[model samples]
Target: MIYILYAVLYGLHIAIPFSIRTEWTVLIVIALLRAVLKLGEQRTNHYIAFTLLAIIRDRVFQALRRLCPTKLEGRDKGDLISLITSDVELLEVFYVHTISPICIAFLVELIMVIFIGSYYWSLGLLALAAFVCVGVILPVIISKRSGNLGDELRADNGELATYMLESIRGLDETIQYGGGEKRLQNLTKKTIELSEKQSRLNKLTGVNLALANTFILFFDIAMLALSSVLYSRGDIGFDGLLIPLVALMSSFGPVTALANLGTTLQATVASGARVLAVIDEEPEIEDITGKKEIDFSGASLENVTFSYGGDTVLNNLSLTFPENKIIGIVGRSGCGKSILLKLLMRFWRANTGKVSVSDVSVEEINTANLCDMESYMTQETQLFKDTIAGNIRIGRLDASQEEIEDACKKASIHDFIMTLPKGYETKVGELGETLSGGERQRIGLARAFLHDAPFMLLDEPTSNLDSLNEAVILRSLKEEAQDKTVILVSHRISTVRIADEVIGMDEGRVS
Candidate 1:
């Protein structure tokens, strides 16, 4: 449209023959309108891009939450971080710059061909061929030749991210063991490999750009030659020849945007594939819903069998726990002490027989209800970076400050907490690293106490505590069990001495 307007001002003044004043005014108005429209187009594109990226991130996080503790058990944390950060970021380029231009280019090119074809059919055909070759054929050829390089590059980048994350986390360990030199060398080697992969992709991008430009140039010359022959033969006038030739030359803007995408789209495409893979993976265990809610009375595993791959962790082991009793389980390491508790929690499905709570199969109980009835504390308590009171409140989010202190007292950590300068408000640092192992363990116990559930699964709960603190906790557990069933697992015979009945597990079964 701009090209046509320019021609009218320069030479086609005879055709419109309005006043020269009117023509100039119209030209200025249209130019201003075009600038306004272009700005709006960009604004709209970015808004859409931002909204879509937000939605994509939300879906990724939701999928992660659902797949967790089972499907994501072995996934690399750094790789997951890469997907959330860099992979999604790569797509911002596609959404903001890539999608709209392709649509605009096709529309503009199609209209131009039709207008030129009205004057002469062969000229239309020539223009059509030029647009298709540069916009379609070249990209397909380049993408095919680049096969799998994009995926490989993204994977290597993720591995490099993982290595760097590990290095930062183990910085203290590395210095203590005098392995900094070896660690540095490994870091350099991994980084160099990543650079080489990226270099190959960049080389492919350069080749694509060169070929795209070549195709455009070759077609431009062909357009001029064909239009010149028709003009000389009197089949079309000078206006017909000049207008189409100019339009074709100026019209490469949209297709040019596409041609350059060869630079960023490879990574974008690879990132998209990786992101989609996470969303598509099936969860190992779906949450049990729509079942009758269960109240904890007593729970048992009946002729239950379970395994981790080929290694059987529990072999048709059956046990019963009476309500309101502290039943102790003692075993060597890896003798299925923890695994038995997991079955009762339904973290893993039994291979055979029924694991029951309230005499109903665990599979037939509502997942939320089951969780509500049991408070299971693992051997290693996981604490976030939060204040002492804040971390304990996770057991019952609405607990009062006094209630928090009460639970801490029962866990035998209230005196230690009071001795600290900040008392209950003291920070635990990352993963509770600022506190001793026993302190962290007591916090876990505090959380469990605050929960006040009908069933408790305590896995090596007193492992880190001194015997004095351990005895205090056991006495508290004895008092607390009047209304809750407790499964106390430990390797220490002294730790289980407070229980009503003690059982031994040897090689995945009762002895």
Candidate 2:
């Protein structure tokens, strides 16, 4: 439409001397309308792009939750972060620019061809050929030449990100071991490699752009020459020649936009594929929904065998704990103590036999019910960058201030917290770095306490605490054991001495 308006105004300006002023006024109106439409198109495109980005991020988060701990174990954290952040953001190019432009290019090309061809069928055919070559043929050729370079480049970028993250995280270790220089060199090498890959992709993009421009130039010359020849041959008049030529020349805008996306689309395609992979991944443990909730009367693992990779972690492990008993699990480092706790929590599925609570296999228990019935605390407490109160409230989001304080008191950290300047309002730095190891452990214990589940699994709950703090926490555990089933895992024999029953594991078997 813009091209047609321009051609009419041009014809009027040249052919009608008296109506030149009117032609100028009409051109100004058309220009203003086009600008308004352009602005609206941009706003709509942005709205769609942003909305899709938010949805994509949410889907990625859901995928992460589903794959967590089990399927995501040992996965690259940095790469996953990249996928959720920059890679997903890269899709805005396709959503906003590529999709609409492709459609617009086709539609505009059809309109331009029909209108121009009305003047001369031969000129219309020429215009159609130019659109196809620029919009379709060039993109296909560029994509073929790019091949898997986009995938490789994206993979390299992810790898570099992972390496940088690891280096930063282990910076202290690197400095202490005099490996900083080596790490720097490794990083430099990876950075250079990424740059080289990026450079190659840029070169391909440049080539595609150059070829597209050359084709446009060729088509422009061909259209002008053909129009002139037809006019001289008397098949068409000067108006027919000039108008269609100008329209065809100006109508390459939409197709050119699409032609420019050829190389960039490769990265978008790669990122989309990565995003879909995570969303489609089958979790290691599928949550069974719509099952009857198990009452936490007692729990047992019957002849359960489990393995990690090729190494057996639990071998025919049979154990039972009755309700309202504090069961202590003691083992050396890799003797399946933590693994046993995970099996009970159903973080992993046992290879054989049954892990059951209340005579029902864990596989049949509804996930939400199982979560409500059990609370597991790891040896290393994970705390976010949030207020002390906020971190504790994670266990029970609706817990009252009194409940939080009560749980902290049970963990024997309430007095210390009160002594702090902020008194529970203090922000724990990232990963609870602002607090002592023992303080973080206590906070984790407080979380488990606040959860108030029927069963609690504590792994090295007091490993960082002094004897006095450890004793206080153990005493509280004993007091809580009157109603709650406690599965206490620790390396210290003294820690389990207060338990109603104790089990020892060695080399994946009962010792």
Candidate 3:
């Protein structure tokens, strides 16, 4: 397309001097058609590129999700958010704009160089060598210089984003303690680091681009002079001189734009590496592929031992909880009570021995099916910024409105919810900030009840409630445990008093 366009435009420019070789009407019509065709080609290429990007986006997200189970632990949420949102988005530029255009430009430039060489071999060689220096050598050198800076900038940006998010979440605490100034000072420090790294990256990019422009300009002048000399010496014809000049001038636009795209390309490279980091992470535990479904008749652990780093949390642990009975596990702080709950949920596999439910190995159970068989509540309850009814409905997504209210009533939070201005429709605010700690725990309990699973695992269910509220919630739990296997972990003696069996655990061992 470019070849034909250049040929026609230059032909018209040269032919117009001698009483117009072709009629003006025909030339105008051809020029208009070429313009329209070029526009159509650009739009079509853009559409095709965008379609390819849309397809790749799904695969990228899936890869990130599959890597999540392993990547989540000890990770900063704000950093992950930045990676998924900003860093990943940068790749779209590379996919939709950079990839195809770079290839097309390279092929176009190569063809122009060859055609120019056919006419004026010496001049074409000069242009070809200059193109290589600008397109290949210069870009590689700039990338090496800016690559590390880009990575540093991205890392700093992720950290700054994380800190900002953390600060926002803890704003109330900072205000309460009159630590706003201190927090601001810390944030200022992060901002400074981010600014410094960003400035360095910008400077590097600017220097490389400036150098490329200078080199391109020098080559342009040199090529024009060389072509003029060859023409003056009768070494090349007027057509040869003018055609190569026009071709070089027209084709240099593509490579010049490519040179300017370097900064984004470098950033894209860094983003790609960051994305691959998450995609390549190995999960702590491997899922069982050929495992049968779990039987929730009873749950037991046999000779189990586990540790994090050098600290042993569970060792030679063995216990059994008969089906349809409330089994309480009580221990002091740091006694691995919550860790036991995690093990039951298969969040972490035991280092040795076996954990089984209804005589089927927990390690061998399918994760999705295992989750369907039990409802596990964490100590620190998490709630979305949604209505009370919506939060409760998460326990059983298909639960009717009546069922949600019933579960809330069972958890002893329905009365308080009704007294609120919006009742069950009120937004909980971020992480249930509108509700008290006790309210959040009850909400979690409501979820467990709505889940209607065969087994319920509660980790400190009454940790946040007042004595009256605690007693009411415990009574509700006791009633629910009648037909379900309840594995309870708590530090409060009153909380465990309702359990049918209370097992004492210390330093990861059953006592």
Name the best candidate (by lDDT). 2
Off by over 4 Å in 3: 1-57, 67-70, 172-179, 286-291, 430-432
| Candidate 3 global CA lDDT score | 0.80
Residue pair clashes in candidate 2 = none
Candidate 2, residues 1-511, lDDT tens digits: the string is 4444545656666453235576677777978988998999899999999999999999988988888779988887778778888789889888999898988898879999998898899999999999999999898888888887877787888888778778888988998999988988988998998899889988998888899999999999999999999999999876777778778778888988887777777778888989999999989987779997667888999999999889999999899988999998888888888888898889999999899988889989999899899988987898888888999999999999999999999999999999887888887763345588999899999999999999998998988889898888999999999999999998888788989988889888888
lDDT of 3 by residue, 102-209 (tens): 786788788888988987789879889878888777777777777667667777887877777788998889899999898889899989888888888788778987
Q: Where's the lowest-lDDT run of ten residues in candidate 2?
A: 11-20
Query: What would the per-residue lDDT of candidate 1 be over residues 31-116, giving only the tens digit for each residue?
Result: 89889989998999989998999999998988887787677877878788889998988888788888898888889889988977
Model 2 spans > 4 angstroms off: 1-29, 430-432
Model 1 error, position 125 (Å): 1.8
Q: List the residue pairs that clash in candidate 3.
A: none
For model 3, the run of ten residues with the poorest summed lDDT: 14-23
* RMSD of every prediction: 2.5, 2.7, 3.3
Q: Tell me the TM-score of each prediction against the true structure.
A: 0.92, 0.93, 0.90
List the candidates ranked by TM-score, beginning with the highest. Answer: 2, 1, 3
lDDT of 1 at 362: 87
TM-score of 3: 0.90
